[model samples]
Target: MRTSAPAAVLFDMDGTLVDTEVLWWETAREVAAGLGHRLTDADAPEVVGRAVADTAAHLIGVTGATPPPSPPPPTTGPPRWRAPQPS
Candidate 1:
């Protein structure tokens, strides 16, 4: 039996193949430090598994910085990926 080609390939950049959570945590830590906030292990849960925007908001809120301005609605923009074509 032959298998069909995949229509799309998903990448689990969070941790399945590559553990990049540590890098995210480090970046959050760095940003917190810049804001005069000390990031602790307790922050890992909120920072590591979250989107960067969420983490930034968390940091800013905790640091007592003025809330960020609301952004325009999201756009579909360009296609992020294209499936491989049969050769």
Candidate 2:
């Protein structure tokens, strides 16, 4: 028996394959610092696992960052992907 290719694949990156929670924490801290606020342990819960726009909005409300820019227009095509080849 053979299987067809999947139409899409999804991976949970934050705590599964890669430890990105620290990266997000540090990044939020850095951005808060740049905007004249120091992020604390209390702040981590709100910033973790949020979209960039949501994070930016939170920063604006807390640290006064300039409003986030509007997103760019969508492109006209299905996104391209490349499957890994067997080695």
Candidate 3:
């Protein structure tokens, strides 16, 4: 399998993989606002991976969404993966 190309690839991960502490979208909106530009709520999802020029263009095109206040970092605890005890 390692030597051959995958006929079908499957991606899998636990909920741990979903953990993210940063709010880059919020940061971008804040910076844009500080630069005298406004970003609305509807515009955030579209801004995720594009270049700065493209993002700015999208914002300009949509007239931007009202960016909400930054959310607090997601609270986390130690993973609960534990071995079962013998009865």
Highest-scoring model, lDDT: 1
Arrange candidates, best lDDT first. Answer: 1, 2, 3
lDDT of 3 by residue, 1-87 (tens): 358444554433322455222355776677677667777766666676555555655655555555436533333467455545445
TM-score per prediction, in order, is: 0.66, 0.64, 0.34
Runs in model 1 deviating more than 4 A are 1-10, 72-79, 83-87
Global Cα lDDT for candidate 2: 0.77
Task: Give the distance in Å from residue 20's predicted Cα in candidate 3 to where it truly belongs.
Answer: 4.6
Model 2: CA > 4 A from native: 1-12, 71-87
Model 1, span 1-87: residue lDDT tens: 999877777877769888998898988889889889898998788888886667877887777777668843443367676777888
Indicate the worst ten consecutive residues by lDDT in candidate 3: 12-21
What does the lDDT come to for candidate 3?
Answer: 0.57
67 Cα displacement, candidate 1 (Å): 3.6
lDDT of candidates 1 onward, in order: 0.78, 0.77, 0.57
Off by over 4 Å in 3: 1-22, 49-53, 56-87
Per-residue lDDT of model 2, residues 1-87, tens digit only: 999777668766658888898899899999899989998888777888876756677778888767747853443367565777655
Best by TM-score: 1
Which stretch of 10 consecutive residues in model 1 shows the poorest summed lDDT?
71-80
Each candidate's number of clashing pairs is 0, 0, 6
Report each candidate's C-alpha RMSD, comma-separated, in the order given. 5.2, 6.4, 13.0
